[model samples]
Target: MANSAPASVWRNPIHFLAFGLGSGAVPKAPGTFGTLAAVPFFLLLQNLSDVQYAIMLVVTSLVGIYLCGKTSKDLGVHDHSGIVWDEFVGYWITMWMAPAGWFYIVLGFVLFRLFDILKPWPISWIDKNVHGGFGIMLDDILAGLMSFVVLQALVRFVF
Candidate 1:
């Protein structure tokens, strides 16, 4: 930025992701846009077998923690809204309960965004204070958990 605090924070990856690979940097709700951008990745991850899905989810979360942490450190920001890799992995976590379907995907997306945005109780708690790798990944992980539980309930009762 022209008068942003640190010079280092304005680097390439931070700049790119800060715009959400240019999406967040748009003139609208960048965070929402960033989350929206994670959809296709979710679809790709959704195609795998249950065992593969589980393995991928674990790996994605683990990798996301490190990646988010490193990126935050580099950007001189903590859990910057621009970083949406956590969003990607988190959405994948939400889809873990069932196979890919537009209804489930859309609902899961909405729920995850709600938990992420409204930050109900614990999500709000984490967003307000935590600052680091786990901090960055924790809220989204929780959102995914919330999505998973709700989706599972819906599947068990309705379907």
Candidate 2:
């Protein structure tokens, strides 16, 4: 992290949105913080129809590529750990197709955060090996997918 702030960051719009208005600029636990930021959004999306939720997730993921990319670039780093809008969208994607209920929502949040933090196998590998905006976004996407599968399977088995 820079001891001094980058002056030009304020002028960059991608940095503005992606950093959560500079929330990502925090020095520690950026991913966790980013995921925390995602929770309210998850609640909102849960109320929408499945198709509406899916469309929103897709659009966010695509825009996240640019948003995350440009913000990382501005920070003079490749996928800096602080930038977490990607994680937000990833969690949304995980929950979008799932049945809507408070219980499932909490479970999904826990599951998504676990996979996100653990980053098992290929997820951890890619996070280490890949670079750029997509790289930052991909691991969380995979983690979200895994969480979604678990949520789906549970719905199938228990419900």
Q: Highest lDDT: give the candidate number.
A: 2
Candidate 1 lDDT over residue span 1-159, tens digit each = 222233333466544543345554444555577678878777777778889989998887787777678877876677665666677767777778674588888888887788777878798898778877778788888888888888888878987
Per-prediction TM-score, please? Answer: 0.81, 0.84
**Model 2 weakest lDDT span, ten residues long:** 1-10
TM-score of 2: 0.84
Error of 2 at 31 (Å): 1.5
The lDDT values for all models are 0.71, 0.77
Error of 2 at 49 (Å): 2.3
Q: Cα miss at 150, model 2 (Å)?
A: 0.9
**Stretches of model 1 off by over 4 angstroms after superposition:** 1-22
Pairs of colliding residues, candidate 2: none
Report the error of model 1 at residue 114, Å.
0.7
lDDT of 2 by residue, 42-148 (tens): 87777888788878878888888889888778778777666777778777867867886778877888888899989998999988998777887888888999999
Clashing pairs in model 1? 17-20, 19-24, 19-25
